[model samples]
Target: MARNQQNELQALQDTLYFIGGKWRIPIINSICNGNKRFREIERSIPGITTRMLSKELKEMEMSKLVKRTVYADTPVLIEYEPTEHCRSFGKIIQEMIKWGESHRAIVLKKRT
Candidate 1:
């Protein structure tokens, strides 16, 4: 591969390493949209088990995409929110949404 191609491939790989997964984007969307509590996130993303959500949240936190806050109280409150870096993904997510909608329409049209 040429030097430019190699650089582009490396960039893509690094991007995927941070946000590549079936659940990561959904989880980020939920948190970014103000679903802070753990239970709220689980509810927002149907079919995600507590164990899986917990693990994914930890991974996102480590990646600096999600911020985890804990409040020491009678009923300890823990919340998750997207970091500025993750918030910057809004445009990308919107583009993905538009593509997905168009793709779904095409797929449905073909099936009918």
Candidate 2:
């Protein structure tokens, strides 16, 4: 159709690619909220397994949005922190949260 419609569709695709999968954005939001360790993230997310958390953390690390560090002492602990790149999109995430809340409210109002 129109050039603007094509651009809009492309942007939607890019956004989905940027925040794909069930665990990615939740992991990002959890890390952003100061859940810095693997166990802590698992604990905060509640239903995520240790294995899945580790896998997602590694993926985010590779994607450059999350930083993973391991300290070589005793049991060997690993910590996860969001990179500056992830923090740069704070406004976008905030807007998504706001939009979701507003949409839910309107939909609930219609239902009731």
Count clashes in each candidate, considering only residues at least 3 apart in sequence or on different chains.
0, 0
TM-score, one value per model = 0.88, 0.82
- In candidate 1, which residue ranges exceed 4 Å CA deviation? 110-112
Error of 1 at 4 (Å): 1.4
Residue 79 CA displacement from its true place in model 1, Å: 1.1
- TM-score, candidate number 1: 0.88
- Candidate 1 C-alpha error for residue 55, in Å: 0.8
Question: Residues 34-108, candidate 1, lDDT per residue (tens digit)?
Answer: 799999999999989899999999988998988888999979999898899988885577678899999999999
Tens digits of per-residue lDDT for model 2, 4-76: 9999999999979988888778788888888887777888897888888888888878989898888997899
